[model samples]
Target: MTRAPATRELRAEPVGSLSVWQGAALYVGAVLGTGVIALPALACRAAGPASLLAWLGLVLLSVPLAATFAALGARYPDGGGVSTYVRHAFGARAAAVVGWCFYFAVPAGAPAAGTFAGAYVATALGGGRRTVLGTAAVLLILVAVANGFGLRVSGRAQLALAVLLVTLLLTAVVTALPHARLRNLHPFAPHGWSAIGSAAMLLVWSFAGWEAITHLAADFRRPARDLPRATAMAVTVVGVLYLAVAATGVLVLGPADGTSDAPLAELLALGVGGTVHVPAAAAALLLTLGTMNAYFAGAARLGAALGRDGALPAWLDRGGGVGEVPRRSLAVVTGLSGLALAATAVTGVGPQPLVLLTTGSFVTVYALGTAAALRLLPRGGLPHRCAFLALVAVAALLVMTGWYLLWPLVITASALGYLRRRQRRDPGRGVITS
Candidate 1:
């Protein structure tokens, strides 16, 4: 086996049993989360029709960002993904911080995904916060159960779910386009052109899962060949879908798009001249499930990798294998996610803050990963220039995150502190490679 040089060999799991389409589905499922449902509305609210510019910009930005991570995953093809990249490019301590940030962030995201679906359900039904919170908790638990069966089972399910979600979303977008009015394009920047930055900040969260799916790239049947193709496929699909839906939301609903809770449903309703709540609700559930399932599955594997490295408890490393389920890690992730749901319920904090928190953590991880790509990719080349520009874009997005950046910062500090203590005590556990 060819080993990753100059560092401890990163564990490569037997993940390549999956097909190219499955790999594409993994990327799609990991990324097209519940954010797709409401993010268009939020962006429209922030930047009027000009939010379409934000959408276009992100789609363009995602090309480089997704390509950067795909190159890393193709090169490394390890369960550690970006964590391994950071470990090789920076050091063990930095990798641990990235790992900690990612592991903890998934729990927060679970609730966000659940709440997103629950909110749609609540709107259709007659429930409120409790209903949303309860639904979210149930969804998280269900995802845990589904992932307990392992990746082969979950990955196929995700493929079906992704197909379902994209079909439903595409149906709404295409059907509603005929009703989209040109007049809505006027007064496009009501909030001012600068508001595109704020809108981009909100939408950045939706673009976060590119790195998350890298954790699963090693599972692709042909990681080097299929991984980049899958990334490209997903990027194209997502960009078109996001742009279409966002544009439809603005055109069909006009100013109402921003305030409407269920813009996708609203677009369908406008097109068909009646409410499409049932199908919309079902689509929302699938979208939520796809996201929750992907993250839970990816995080479980990542947790086991962290455990094996002593970044987390060793017990998590036991009972793990490629394609085989990581039960202990699944339990830990599920338990933390349940706790996050409870915290949301108890504190009456809505999903927005949790979304922001998780997004902030992911942004931090992406920044580190992109920086690593800058170092790893050949110098003074197209790939290097792309990584450098991606680094700058991600840095700008992190700055836009503002106080939400606090969560990842605290996690990084805590991780660094822990590693410092461990290194001091052991004196020779593992060397931090540059």
Candidate 2:
């Protein structure tokens, strides 16, 4: 077996400026994103009260997944993130597939996330589909504008939003506990026990960010030591919050939990008792802004990097350099996301399919990343063990993902086709368009 270079073999790597606390904050921001806006309700609908099991399962699963990525990051420490690790473990062909999956996933997924927040706004303002689509459209535009203009939201501001999101969610769960009834637990698996697997697949969106922070691993002051600590802290916080919210939705809202698109807002209304719409919508939108903005910037930059690396068309490669604004890449992402949103609105298919599609892509990335970890990390070590477990888990997730996996499969083919064509043209090193 041609194994990757073990961690101990690499020496004299440069350290970075981020502390444990800062790294943890970044992880929180990355993983605890806009999915929380509506996932509990959606998952509840999928599996009735039993969706809590899926939530808990995903939470528990995140630890090994997070650890696997952290171990990979501490060793390779590249901005290429999963693509870099895949390259080391497999080859450039496989790496390109990972890059395409990730880059294209943002466009496919962003609309769903925006629609999640949009549902909250619609719930608050009473505009129904019009309001929801309008809000989602505005969000997509704002994210593009922010990234295109080089407008940066400070880390402290993002941290504040994360804190506020957690606190608000906890408040809803705690205050609403008084209304929770044991009766709601009855008929737990209304859709059958098999529904639990479906819920687990949908909930993958909630836990998809473990590899995101890997890109910044080199920026951590001590990647080996601090990466795991940050991952652990983020896992604990995100798990507790997700569990509390899902459990509270099941118990407090009962049948309503399976219906409402804006379940968090509903929870706030039930908990706070009267007139929580403004505050709830405001909080949700602010948090969504922070989450989507960061995602847009990151995905745009990744698209640029992929383009520059010949994994994508070179038209996007212009802004891959440090401090350069990836306007072309950003435009493509924004345009694609907008089209996705428009299609969903016209077809009235809602965000569930979008969520599944995005989750499908992430699961593919996770599978490859974990498989890479098994080869990259030292043999007979704890990290390797975690990676093995994570690989098994992700394989199961990819299965649960079912038909949605088709999307990533198509992306994989496109990536390979692009690489093959580019190789034919250059017959050597790849060239750029602009």
Candidate 3:
């Protein structure tokens, strides 16, 4: 089936194959990634113990933001995700912009995510840059191959990854708590209160994935019945684990929390009282795999949908329908990810910048996605209320994102340009809005 997959017209999945637990696992896998391994330390550097407040604040914001996407996903149940919502609310041109932002951001972010996990592997195995690059290449390829088989395989793999990573995180938190010194809380605002904003910007990387699962919402056995349930489960798990880990890192390691190479590894070692790099590396691998798997699946499907809707090339529309694997679009995503990794390796750019770039794009997506929800959802309903709240929060995030928004802006122009060019070529198939 991987060869061009199946050809079918656009339709809501006849019946989704994913169960509630599986959907929840996919959500967890998408949102809980390498950020847990390094972001707490990075945020602590940006704002000291005050970073905990930043983490908590994001977890709180997640309620409405996640709800907004879940509501849209449940209502639409299409692979186009926010792009589909935007198409319904605004028009084709705007939906294309949303699609391009998300579809392209996956590749830009893949190198960063892969490198994070690879760094852990290198630290554990003593291979350094080569190990990091090799590990990243392998992960990208594995995730691509898995998704090429369709969600049946990738979703289950994500479930397994979620189970493992969640257990490791909880264990690290529980065991490390005894060693946490209350003194760590003393210098909470050491970087000054303004630094909390910086920390929140960095934490946006950790929070970006909440919208990703919307692309796969159609795969749920009963999207309307199961999407919100899965979202709630994922939000609770992600919030608790993130808060627990952030607090544990700050309390146990104090100033060192801001500088640790692998904060989660150090925390686990302190609790377990021995060398834990190997298992820590394993957990990192699972985390990266889960993240890449989810994104590859969602992005591939979204690409096909964009293609099917004439936002992207018709050649890519082969797998836009339900029960079809977007192998062609998957190939495009994988190729772009490899090229992104290569560019970073050659140019000596760091993961941090790539992360900010990714976050910027995702924030732009959330801005438009929430706006689309505000228009598409029933007025005066719970979903509409959540969308309103989410739109407000996303606006704040846009300002915080600063110059990092440049990438998505360029992508926006590119999307619009591509559409205009297509319109000039085929006036019959063009519209300013869908």
Q: Please, what are the lDDT tens digits per residue for candidate 1 over residues 1-434?
A: 11233333343544566677777887887787887887888888889999999889888889989999888887777667788788888767778889899999998878777888888888778588877887888898789889887777787888898899888888888888898888989898999999998888888878878888777776777788888898889999988888888888888889999898789889878776676787788888898888888788778888887777767766887645556677999899999989988887888886667778888999999899999888777788776787888999999888888899999989988887877777787767643443
Clashes of 3: 4
Clashes of each: 3, 0, 4
lDDT of each: 0.82, 0.79, 0.89
TM-score of every prediction relative to native: 0.94, 0.91, 0.96
Which pairs in model 2 have colliding backbones? Answer: none
Off by over 4 Å in 1: 1-15, 380-382, 424-434
The candidate maximizing lDDT is 3
RMSD of 2: 3.2
lDDT of 2 by residue, 1-434 (tens): 12343344222144555567766766776677776777888888889998989988888889888988887877766556788787777777788899889888988888788777877788778888899889989988987886686423333455667777778888888888898999999988989999999999988988888887775565566777888898888899888888888888888889998888777878888889899888788767875776676577667767776777678877897865544567898899899989988888888887888889999999999999999888888889988999999899899998898899999999999988887898898878653211
Q: Model 2's lDDT to the true fold?
A: 0.79
Worst 10 residues of 1 by lDDT: 1-10
